[model samples]
Target: MVLTADSYRVLRGWVNGLGYSLDARLIPYLELAGFGSATLTQTFDLQYDLISALVERWRPETHTFHLPCGECTITLEDVALHFGLPIDGDVITGVSVIAEPAVLCYSLLGASPDDTDSTFSKLKFTWLKANFQHLSVNATEEESVCPARVYIMHIIRGVLMPNLNNNKVHLQYLPLLADLHNVRSYSWGSAVLAMLYHELCRTTKPDAVDLGGCLVLLQLWALYRIPFLASVSHQPYVFLLVNRWSIYPGIGRLYTVLIYRLMIEQHTEEGFIWMSYRRPEIAAIIPSSSYVDSQLWCTNAPIISFNIVEWYHGDRVLQQFGYIQYIPDLPMPVGDVHGINKRGKHGQHWRVTHQIFVAVWENRMA
Candidate 1:
């Protein structure tokens, strides 16, 4: 059937609701995000198709593009360290672009071996620098960068100090608030969570890992700042959930559920609407090749990446979009173990059912 103007508009509206601005350029990326395949060749094509479309449409001549994480303060030293000595009154400190469900950045300074610990700082700096550019906070502006700093400072303060009368967490280190909004908190929080998760898997010490701590920290950051991500209907989390790792499915589910519960509780009506509409587009990012079933049973694959597919729906926003159900038992095929073993194909099949879920939320009006 021929695509109609109205139909095209509807689809375009669908894509924009996913987060891209309503423009022809974003169409290809929207399409790629929905394709599913189980082959490496297919994934490469999807990536290429979307990237090519963006490059062609935006036609960004400069090496740098606006970043989309958040605002922060970046010192002159930080800029120089990242991009080297000034070239023509400025140098490219970093480059950032949104890729599907997440923001990606490649910076010069943080690339150093010694700066491994500085990952979050670098990411935050890049996010702020990009946002500053977006807001036209040029170096020559009379208000200058200081005003911007103060602005972000206020936001950080507002988030951390929701109520001066009530003591929540220790806010003695108020200065760190600004740093937390950008990438620093997220990066460090992510790293800490990953390490803790790994430890949980390795040692089976869920009690010692403090899952709530990491979730609390991330939730606070996401709530107070990072509204863009917090606004998203689903947040992607990757973890191993295999028997060999001795990791229980419940451990993974708990963390995912915690994030959703806390985030939803914090959501304003606007946030809920934002998520409901965005769920489809975000859910569409699960590439066709990345099926949870195969990933679970696939051999020779690092179990981590496959697990990411499973946790994709744990959030409330996404969970609200869908439901999960578990079936306990089913009839087993009758056969002798030796006969089945000799055949090496199928003999007695044990009947078992796992959780089944669906996304039922309607897309918001565009």
Candidate 2:
């Protein structure tokens, strides 16, 4: 079974197309949760082929792309700078199997699905839109918080850490959003990266077709790092660098997936910009806020999100972080660990199930 370049292209339909109507009432909550930096000024489209090209280059064994230029993978710094999400903070883990999905929704989100299935932990995008998009004009502070939670839920379910269920959002994350004030404390960016890493690893199998993670992130990370793949951006620079590809057209959009695959294969080390973010012109636009805890961008730790655990190997790609590039040591052998997930092992707490990696994530001092 030969895995051709095209075999890796997993076709997907986006949930964000349901529309982004972030109510003005929710900005305060969004700002509180450190998500204010994520700008969704426009509803966007994704080229699955572009993402497929990058996946073809991804080496799940090392969790880095084996490009002609050298090993390069999306770093915590890229997640922090590009999306402005918190990278260094609490590990995002919780009960995957919510016993009472409807009750959980009603308690935190102020509403639940009309048709309640006892085993269902996922809510439809339309339900969230119908219940939360239009907050009451005279909504109380408490009432406002509910919609804010829903908005973040929509973002996560739609793009950030989406599953294969395009229309339905898993209700497991709703528990974490219970305290709107503390939402910022969780390392959402890390979890997002973890999910992407898992997706990259899964797609490497010849039979895998469906992908379930933030595709936008992988595509943007590639465009920003590879100077050749990035397009000329005339738009004024935005902090969360998603502006480059989200709202405006980029060079990758103009090329076919085959072209992108060929371009990546032909790429040489000189064409890769190891530290493009540190450029004077680029640095000038990024506000000081994004640099907080700049130390953790190179954390040599595991990026954990619930049952999913994937290694974040910043040491391997030191050059991308402005450090002198050296051939680093081998990737930690994660033998059967990468295959761990919340399948038949239902109703178990992630903290206990993934205790080993969670310990590494908890003691994230670096």
> How close is each model in CA RMSD to the real structure?
25.1, 6.3
lDDT minimum window of 10 residues, candidate 2: 232-241
What's model 1's TM-score?
0.18
Query: Mind giving the per-residue lDDT tens digits that candidate 2 earns over 1-366?
Result: 333434435445344654756777678788888777674623555657667677778888789999888888887887788778888778999887988877777789777785447778788888888777788888999899888888888788787887777787787888888987888889999999999899889877877766777777777777767766665322334213443433544322323455567767776466787887888999998888888877887777888888888988888988787888777778875557786877787778887778888888788783
Q: List the residue pairs that clash in candidate 2.
A: none
Model 1 over residues 246-353: C-alpha lDDT tens digits?
A: 264333334333333344344433442322313466446544333222211111110010011011111211122233323312312112211111123222111111
TM-score of each: 0.18, 0.87
Give the poorly placed runs of model 2, Cα more than 4 Å off: 1-15, 39-42, 232-255
lDDT of each: 0.22, 0.76
